[model samples]
Target: MTQKNTEDPSSQKNDSDCGCGGETGCRIEAVLSVDERGQMVLPKDVREKAGIRTGDKLALISWEKNGSICCLALMKADNLSCMVKDILGPLLNEQDRS
Candidate 1:
């Protein structure tokens, strides 16, 4: 028996079709499968292209809409920390005023 490609066509989008209308926007690089142990391996080429190396840490982020998970994203741990600070810095300031 053969398995059919179950990938969504929209997920095969390029940067232009990312709905962001930007040349440097995100793209659907590859589809991955999680094993029975709930582990997934990033393809070697994809990892190389993204500059991911051994012992690197990644932060998993999820987006929810209407109480359902809509998207999942991964970013470098250091970058994630910076982003959290950038977002929460202003919010923390507001709390100080209150």
Candidate 2:
């Protein structure tokens, strides 16, 4: 289900490029479709750019706004683990000292 974005950037209809008429740092990279089995394939380009390889673990993170999920993100499991440890490790140590 991988497809290349052949559309030319210049020909893009949206004049909302940016206030400076330059590309924005954050923009849509690819659109993915989910199959009947609820399986979706991340575009090859996005996967490669993100350094995702076969069998790599990704944690699907979601953000809730006003009780509704507003955004979704993916992070490497190992990095997520490191972040959790960095944030909670100190708190746990403080509790142990208490």
TM-score of each: 0.61, 0.65
Tens-digit per-residue lDDT, 1-98, candidate 2:
99999999776766333232335355567888989999989999999999999999999987665676666778899889999999999999999999
**Predicted candidate 1 versus true structure: per-residue lDDT over 1-98, tens digit per residue:** 99999998756866333234335476777899999999999899988987889998999987665676666778889888998899999999999999
Q: What count of clashes does model 1 give?
A: 0
Off by over 4 Å in 1: 1-24, 87-98
Q: List the global CA lDDT of all models.
A: 0.79, 0.80
- Candidate 2, run of 10 with poorest lDDT: 15-24
Cα-based lDDT at residue 29, candidate 2: 73
